[model samples]
Target: DSNFLFLFCYSTYSNKVFSVTFLSLAVAVIIPLFGAIILLKCPIDPQPISFKEPPVLTGPLEPNFKLRQAERLFENQLVGPESIANIGDVLFTGTADGKILKIENGEIHTLARLGHGPCTGREDEPTCGRPLGIRVGPKNTLFVADAYYGIFEINPVSGEVIPLVSSKTPIEGKNLSFINDLTLTRDGRKIYFTDSSSKWHRKDYSLLIMEASDDGRLFEYDRVTKEVKVLMGGLRFANGVQLSPSEDFVLVAETTMARIRRYYVSGLMKGGEDMFVENMPGFPDNIRLSSSGGYWVAMSAIRANPGFSMMDFLSEKPWIKRIIFKLLSQETVIKFVPKYSLLVELSDTGSYRRSFHDPNGMVASYISEAHEHNGHLYLGSFRSPFICRLNLKDV
Candidate 1:
């Protein structure tokens, strides 16, 4: 009886081990098979992106918690104030809900509605009209670059909206797909803007960055002549547009490449292009002229960090990006990116002056632009619901 009991216990143990091994083997085989099938069915055609070595976070590029001191303005009252423009104390910004709003004395008022009906969320962005770059144009007017509907000239007082450039307007034999940021000349006659992508709309911007296609174009528009001309082409996710104080050369932020490019508009190198700043510590968004005749570049994503940067790692690996897109949705893929807020100041010659950081993104993340006015910096974001104001004297 003793021998029989011991044998029975051994038999039971052997069966349990066998069952566990079988389940492990099955999972090992099934997971790769499912992944292979998903990779094969991926729709994205990724292009190889050559990214420079990330800059070292030393000297002026060192990380800090300065941005944590930023104060929120009109918190939860609006959403996605992506760009900010102002005349004296009155501030103007475009919100995610397709409205151009005016803020004065802590009051928010609608100046103009670009799209009809109620905008429920981001999915309605294409139809609701996502306004990106806003600049104070000639005669106290506002020039807005709407990602879906093209550019418009809006009267700040009466809220009159006039279409300056249509999305259907073709330049260089191609229709504009993603009209992003714009900068006007001193007289606001000639407008320079960036078309972010030829294949993706504003809503699918994440896909454009993952695909890393060089289909972006920079354009020059003459308000008087109604003529639009392509200034530079084949840019990778071209974003912000800013002209130098002298208006000799214009700078465009190539977001995916983590660099700023200089295109000569009225210099000895007219019609030529060169690198303004390369291998930034993060992806640059909108660049505005600083109070000291420099440039304030807003970084949407920090590349150099202790944590993983999925976008930075995928920059050189197109096959990996294809697999990621196949297995994960756009929203899921974006979740892999770490959060951080950063802003860099560049000299007139593109030298790094200094940088501000919210390394943990406690106060703000995905800072889009920094506009300096009256000893303060008004910050904008594409993801944050409210704007931030940082006192320059304190920081």
Candidate 2:
């Protein structure tokens, strides 16, 4: 629109001039974004998890966790939801189908298709395995860390998806098959993310214990240098990656282990990592710090489905695991049914502060994403158009 746009179009990101265009807003409206940037640096003011004496609920009526169907958007299914990012009022989520969604005012719409593949019927096989992590920034920039295609950036309004970082360079597809959550540093100089597993894609979660591979890793991408560096290596399903409100520490969810760990960025414990919460009631999928305080943790499933848990128990027998997987893969006539419930909300230490669950399997298993926007918690699935919204005030 103006020369001011071209002259400063590619601002330095990571290390180089990346693809984002930053427009200074009267300088007054910039405060909030700046405040969010500051969130990336506050020292890790961790509320230690007293494991020796885990907190317990002493009351009868815990918040009811139930899932009531709301509405439908597409006839297809969802993969794992890695991270849910809110931009303004639009809630954008990335899916296994290589697509990102723009949920506006309670209506569903596709924001951009990041990659392609067969799981969701896309022509390009590599782009379609699954998309997990997504974040929206001040200028409406959408950054996504996909399971198969690595990392991507998109224009929320135009559907222009760009490959920002892929396993092509330092890390290869063989190294990062399940690229998980991602976050931008407060200064926007570095982008951090995780690869949940090297041996398991969303379809192969059953193999995590079977393979026992030392694969999960955390990485930092420098835009200015166009280099992606490893921060933490060898994790148990490196699932959720979030920066502390102060931007001083990075919190990562080890879903396969049902615990959240904090990696310091700046502080007395820089480079140190410790447990924030462990043995979540269920497998922790993703975590978001609420504007009002407290983190919303989504327990992907209260427990692995009986069929899957059975496989875990029979791990010594590979043939049994294989046979069961094959059977359950085709167990349904309609391909899916509302069978179980997955709820996520505030957790008071080891206690459940409040939760939302939708059984009957309507919400499905292997929930990849969950986030809280305003007072409503949104859920994205790995199997159906299982996008859901629950009123968090009930908690």
Candidate 3:
């Protein structure tokens, strides 16, 4: 009887064990298969990006606290002063709400409007206009690059905004998705600008950078001919555009690529392109010419080591990138904002001149532009509600 009972119990337990084992195996296989299917269905198409390793960020600015102690001029009054232009004692900057604000003696006034409607947030950018670049052209005419409205020429005195080019307008059969930073030639015969991304709008900048999109481009618009030409294509989040002091070359910032490229506009190398500076520590935004004979580049956010490094590694894996991008929210994609701020100076030949850093962002962060005027450096930001001013002597 004892042998029979033991045999019966073993039979019942083995049957249950087989069922459990089978279920566990099925789940183990099906879970991964399901995930694979979902990933395959993901729409976040990404491409590979390869470049030389970045240089060491070390410099004389190891502990420089310049930006942290800088002065804030228009605190909490404006939103996203993306670029700066100075005429005499007056400062002009573009805002997120499609308005160009003029600053004089610390007072702020609206200079022009790019759109007809009020933009309360990013969703209304198309309707309300978001000006990303501003420059003072010939005869004090303000050139603005609105993300949604395309290129514009604003009369600083009359507050009149004229659309020089619409975003819907196509160049070389390609329409601009985001018209970004702009610069005008000395003789005012031409204007150069960047289209940050051909696949995403200004509000989706996080996605654009994360995806490492190569749809960004550099363009030139001839004022006399009213013709637009694509000077460079297949760029990675192309941003700020500036011409060489001698007007022989144009520099375009490829933000996600962490580099600047020079397109020869004149001289023997005319129509050729080359790297100006490579392997930057952060995403390059607007670059401006300094009164001291070099250029100042605003490093929007310093690349966060470990985290950003991992992302860059994953950028090469298309399948992994698609899944991660599909699951990540826009805020989470851009949540890696570094607390540090930076402004790097380079010679006209693209050699390093100097660098300034704010390790804690006590004074400013996400600075998009740096302009030198009257011995003072006025800084703009993509998100800061104020423009910061710093003394060149102190720096």
Give the per-residue lDDT of model 1 (tens digit) for 32-120. 98777664776578887776667778888888888988999889998989999998899999988989999999899999987765688
Off by over 4 Å in 1: 1-24, 305-307
Model 2 is weakest, by summed lDDT over 10 consecutive residues, at 43-52
Error of 2 at 261 (Å): 1.8
Ranking by TM-score: 1, 3, 2
Model 3 C-alpha lDDT per residue in residues 21-80, reported as the tens digit of each score: 999999999999878768555445677777555555666424477787679887899988
Model 3 misplaced stretches (Cα beyond 4 Å): 1-43, 60-63, 304-310
Query: How far out, in Å, is residue 271 in model 3?
Result: 0.8
Weakest ten-residue segment in model 1 by summed lDDT: 304-313
Q: Which ten residues in a row have the lowest lDDT in candidate 3?
A: 303-312
Give the per-residue lDDT of model 2 (tens digit) for 15-98. Answer: 242222233443546787556554443211211111122223223212233545433334354444445678878777776566
lDDT of each: 0.89, 0.61, 0.84
Best of the two (2, 3) by TM-score: 3
TM-score per candidate: 0.92, 0.70, 0.89
lDDT of 2 at 201: 66
Error of 2 at 148 (Å): 1.3
